[model samples]
Structure formats: structure tokens, C-alpha cells
Target: MSLKSVSAKIFAKIVVLRIQKWANNPIETQQKVFKQLISEAKNTVFGKDHDFENISSFENFAKQVPVRDYEELKPYVDRMVSGEKDILWPGKPLYFAKTSGTTSGAKFIPLTKESMPYHIEAARNAILCYINETGNAAFVDGKMIFLQGSPEMQEKNGIKTGRLSGIVAHYVPAYLQKNRLPSLETNCIEDWETKVDAIVEETKNQDMTVISGIPSWVQMYFEKLQKSTGHKVGDLFKNFNLFIYGGVNFEPYRAKFENLIGRKVDSIELFPASEGFFAFQDSQKEKGMLLLLNSGIFYEFIEATTFFDENPKRLTIGEVKTEVNYVMLISTNAGLWAYNLGDTVQFISTKPYRVIVSGRIKHFISAFGEHVIGKEVEEAMHKAISAFNFSITEFTVAPQITTSEGELPYHEWLVEFDNTPENLQKVAEYLDSEMQRQNSYYLDLIVGKVLQPLKIISLKKNSFQEFMKSQGKLGGQNKVPRLSNDRKIADALVKI
Candidate 1:
């Protein structure tokens, strides 16, 4: 083995040991982070306004700080954006992660010096943990590619600002620089399709071992490679063995990926965002991600079922239970206080606090009180495809509340198939049955005659890509919502 490969294996062991210390003491580690965040920012503008000086415990902190989303927190953020110091954190942030927002044009999530390292380190540790568990560090010697936004950044009031992926691009460690690809010039291409084409040309003959990106976008890259070389991805890049992905469930896309690659490969799922790097898959045998407790972020959970209640109960890490959906809230070292991240998660294991991102709080279909979530829809789709031995390229679900004639409103599944089923109606009925089985409220609605069985609409090739392009979000961390409450997405798909 090369010297670097040997060193990586040794270093991976050390990192895993350090992580185990906190992973085994989840609550205590979180408490220390909570105290440290409060102590460090006690003199900042937000800390003083929220009375952080007298706050002694989780209860005290919770009582003093109310949960705020991006819109609610904009007043304080505006001051920071205007070049004010200590408005939220102890000093000016090193960077602002620019992300698209629904109401606002864009959101600038501050990344302070203290909190930024955790984001970079968490990503590194995920791979190290895998190496420690499986004794495979050989990929470290081969080429790696993370399909991301351009590293080109803009300066806003003296702070560097860009998309989170682009901002992260600047922080790739020196050790990986030699192995990382598409060349800096190609990565800076503004158009995603053009960028992927450049990437294909740049790395077509290299010994690529690690390919990472959002699954949907990476699928597009793989398709382009196959079209160019007329070979499966595995044949073109024989060493490509690890696939790292985030931002969506991988199960729904697994069959399609295996088909494209011509073989099965190990994969890692990450739960990262502009707000914070929360969790990552730590075990190949496990179902969920290891929640980071000592990462300079204090977490609170409000049960998703009771999230809209007047004054719902807020629970700390110690109080969270497995299998219950909760809206994740965080008070971070980056100056966000009791911030609502909007993503809902369910704990798969609480022994060391591992969770799976279930869905976004606002991204659900509750038009008829059925309250179906992203996880339900994704799981239902996966089950249906598996049962019928079919494969799909992409899909999204939305409710059609206004139907013609006397029929009840129903969910419309817009699916792009790689392998069509022999019986479309039978597959749709199976999908509907699976959905009803997963959600009791949905079952109740179906039984009570309030809604009809879901209808599947077959979409042409590249429909989702066209839709994304129409919205000016074709690639670079963009993804189609798995489920929406209304027909906005469904209508667009039909029109396309």
C-alpha cells in the first residue's frame, strides 16, 4: 500500500475512537455543547437580548428563546448581513451559505469559525468511520469526485458568500486535492449540463473510486457517461466502489443506480444542510445515521404530531424516543438560537442517538387530513417497484383536490419509469395499498370514501430535468420534492 493509504487507516482508527467517546455519552456531550454555546455568546447582541446571562438549564434556555425560522430571524440576520459584529455570534462569520428560499429570495446561513470546522470534519469522519469498520482505505489512493457547485464566490460586506456546496468546495482538505476531480476550470462552469459534460471528458479514463453527489444529479452524470462510452459506469470506472449521497432517500433510487452501474457498491448517506451537519451513516449494517451531539450545536425536538399545537412540549436529547417523528430545532455556535430547521426526523436508535430524516415539516400532503409524509411516499414507491420487479428513474407525488365529474380527489403519482410494469393499474393499486398500510390516517380517509385510490401518471424521459430547468434549479444540490400538499408540481409535470 502507499504511505498515504496506510496513514489513512491509522488516522481513521484514532478518529473513530474519539467519536465513540461522545457517541456513548450522547446526553452528557449535548449538555456540554449547550453550555459552551451559551457561555461563549453570552455577551453578543442576541445573547443579551434573550437573557442568556441567567439561563442555567435546558428548561431555562427553552423558556427564554422561542423557536424562529428564517423569516422570523431575519431582523437579526439583516444586521449581520450589513457587516455588524457580534449580532448573533461572538464575531463576524467566515462565510454565509446561500440557499434558495420559498418566501424569501435567498437565505444566508452564517458559518462561524467555530461551527465551520464541524461541517468539514463531520464529512471526513463519515468516511473514516467507514474505513474503521470495514478496513477499506484503498479508495484514498484513487481519484474521487464530488459533483458540486462552483468554488467561485462573491464577497458581501466583507464576508464570502455562495451556495453551501460551493462554500464547502473551498474547504476540501489538502490531502484529497490531488485525488479530487473535474479540474477547477470545468467545475466553475455555470451551466450544470455543460459542467457534467466537462467532468465526463476530464475523468473518463481516470481510476475513479469515489463518486459523490445528490443521487438525482449523479444519475444524470452516469447517464451521460454511458451515452458517451456505451459502457456501464462500473466498466468505465472499474475502481468506482463507493457512492456518497445526501438530501434524499436512496432506497427509491437504489435499483436504478445498480442497473446503471452494472453491480452493487457500498454507499453512504449524509444528513447535511445549510443550517448544520447533523448526522451521517456510520455503519453499513445500520439503518440510520449517527447524530452528532458534540458538534457545537444544541438540539431540541418537538413532536411532529403536536408541532402545531398551542405551546407544544419541547424535549431535549435525553427526552427523545425512537420511532416518533419530531421537528428538529437547534441553537448553534453560528448564532442561530432555537432555530426551526423545518426538517422532521425519527430516531431509529437512541442508544447513541441515531436518526433518519423523515421529511420537511411543510412538505407533506395534508389537504384531506391524511397527513402523508415524504418517507411514507418514498417507502410506498420502493415497495411497489420491488413487488412488481420494475425500476423507475424519478417520481413525485401531489394531491389532486379538484377532479372532474363525481369522483373523489386523490393523489397523483408522476413517475418516470426505466422498466415499465406489465400491468399499470395493478401496480397503482399495490402502491395505494402500501400507502394505506403505512399511514393510518390515509387508510381512514380511503375507508371513509373521502379519497379515491392514487393514480399513476407515466412521464416521458427527462421530465424532471426539464421541470427543474424551468424553475432555474437544474442541478447542484437541487432535488424534486417527494410529496407536496397541492397540485402545483403535478400540474407542471402534466404540462411538460
Candidate 2:
């Protein structure tokens, strides 16, 4: 049926408010909305055993809730692995969007029916914002492809059901719902290559109007697209209109995509979790992304610096400050309250609360007093790769400084690319320049002897996914966790 009118109205109605909400709202308005959400969240889960006595008792109550890893929620998480039905949601959940954990074993985060409306709304808001700003709905007018894992959902009775890829197909825009291209499934849970052959078989020669999914998988998708056809990357997607991507940093793979499509991709970011979709790029051309303000759940941010504190404190929607980086904290209907999602981001401006992802708190590098985080690495890479425009297919950095008589550890990078000349030295030189530009402390430390120069090593073809697969962490939602901060990934990257 025609959600065109509904879609048009939804997208149009929020244009001004979304812009205002993302950029610079009145402080009082922000606080009022924040407080209302807090009250709504409390009221939403009041009888569900999430006890928050009052706002004053929140600090201590926050401490009382255990800091949980995915494994801690294994039982509930299993239900979400892949399937249509689970206790995680109120109604039957439409799909099981698979994401990996520390290892692949089971980071199966369930998307609950109780919470999918928010995801749909956020996605709508992003599309609407883009249309209002750039009039780019032509991106949606074409055949959209979501490069996700299998349609598998874990069941309470211990069997996975529905393809994760299948579930998303069911829930996306109805106009495109019937036109979803066939997905590469069956082995989505096994590892990466299982879907490689399938990715190629399906994507080849297809007119992909809009493509969205994890960055790594997207890279792999087109790489195989190039290999299978014996042509360059652009040959596979010449008809591509727009590319929407998320779940990992798009910097590394962007160049490759440009080469393959032979065009400047119109990209948008989506911030959805296994639990639910949160926010996305509202306008096609804006510094800040629009916040899905009234989506199913309420969102809040904790100061990034304070997130790792022993007694980490959380700022309410009204109380949280902006512009600085903050770890994402969500109050979702999916059995999580004040949940620390581990990812971090920065506020571009808050009138409309547009934010740019900084990086993950746990995925940080602390070699030799250089607390290098994902955002630092991403910004450095974004600037350094400006000339080459070479999409970084896969990359990881190991922190080690040359210890000459107690020398500190430095960063050693391993990158995979599809290019003619593989000049490691040139890549390293530019990386050093970027490091100096992005982080003054890092530059000062390099001069003062805490770290050494950066190193870039290119990997053989198809090595990245092989490395991820071997570790049982390869799939749609999972990526090659760029800043490993350890030797495990280095060993894995080199071996692959």
C-alpha cells in the first residue's frame, strides 16, 4: 500500500523541528524534553523491576545496576539471535538482526516488537530529513539492498528461526518491501566467506539503487563483485544512485566504494542497535544528524570522560551537556535501562541534537600514555586519506613504541586495499602527519618520546574477512574492530 502520503507527511513535518532539534534548541526546551523522557522511561518500566526511587537516588541506583557484558544476558539474548518471536518484545518480533560479540559465540541481541516502532521511526526521520534538506528520495526510489547476516533468530526452545536479513526486509518501507533482492544467508552465522559467494551471485549486474549495511560487509560485497566479474569495482554498481551505510566507520571502505561505483556516493548514517534503531542522518547535507526524538525509546548520553569512571555518572536528557564526546546510554523497552551501549559519539550541535560518532569506549588504545580512541583514529584517517580517496577495505592498529632502552610502544597498522601501487611507506608518512594534526598530545608525545612513527602494512586480497572468520567473529553487524590495542588482532591480521 501507499505509505507515500504518510511517509511524505512524516518526513515533511519534522524538517524544521528536526533541524532545530539537531542543532541549537533553547536550553529550557531541551531540558523539558529530557525530563519528560526520563519520566516516560521510568513510567514505561516502572513495574518491570527497574527501580529508580527518584532523580536524587539515580546516581546510587545507577551504581547498583551491574555493568553487564552480552554474555550476562545470554538467555534473553539467545531469543534475539534470530527469529520472529521472543519474550524480548511485546508483539512478535519481525526479524533477528545478527550482531557479533567479543567472540562470535553469541552476541545475539534481540530486537523486540515492543521496540521496533522506534527503529522504523528513526529510519523514517533520517529519510525525511534527507529529503527535506537535499530532495534525495530518488535514493529510495531504486532497489535498496541491506547487506546484513542471515534471517536467523534464536528461539527460547533453543533453535534459531527466520533470517536476520529476512526480518529487516519485512520491516522496511512497504514500497521497497516486495522488491528486496535475495540475501546471502544459510551461513551468515558461520562466518564471512559463507556469504561472499552469495553476495557476489546476488549483487552482480543488479541495479542497486540504495545500499545499506555494515561497512566491512559492504567492502567485502563489492570486492567479491569485482573479483567475480574480473572487472574494476565500478563495473558492478554503475547504476547505483545512493549508498547508505552504518554499524562501522565508513572511512576505510569509502575509497574502495568510490573506485567500484566510479562516483561520489551519497551516504547517510544509521544508528540502530540489535535492540532497536536510535538515530540517523536526517538531512542529506548537514553537519549534525537529526535525533529520532519521539521514537519508541528515550536516549541519553553520559560524558565520555566520565563513562569509564569507577563511579561513572549519567546525565539525564535535560542534564547532559553537548559538543563533547559521550558514551551512549539508552533506555530501551528491550529489557535494558540506563544501558551502557559501549559506543561513544560527539554532539555536532544540539538544537536538533545532531551528533557524530566518536568511537567505542572499550575499543580504545592506551599504549605508552597515548589514550588513542576510535574517533582519534577515524579523524586522522579521514584527513590523511583525502588525497588517495582510497577506500580502506580492512585495517587494524597495534600499539607499540620502539622500546630502545625503555622506549614506549607505538602504533603498527595493517591495512587491506585494492589499488595498483601498494606503497606502505607513503601511507605511513601521511598517517604520521594526520596523527600530528588530529591529536596535539600525540604529536607532543612523539616529540617527547612516548610513541614512535606510524606503520601501514597492506594485506593480501581477501585476508581481512578470513582473519575475522577464523576468530568466529565475521558477519554483517560485526567488523574487524579497527583499534585492537593488543597482539591478537595483529597476529590475526598478519596471518590472514
Name the best candidate (by TM-score): 1
Window of ten residues with lowest summed lDDT in model 2: 44-53
lDDT (Cα, tens digit) per residue for candidate 2, span 187-281: 34345575667656776777676777787777677767777888765556665766777777776667667776677767888877666676687
Candidate 1 lDDT score at position 57: 94
Clash totals for all models, in order?
Answer: 0, 36
lDDT, candidates in the order shown: 0.93, 0.63
RMSD of each: 0.8, 4.7
Give model 1's clash tally: 0
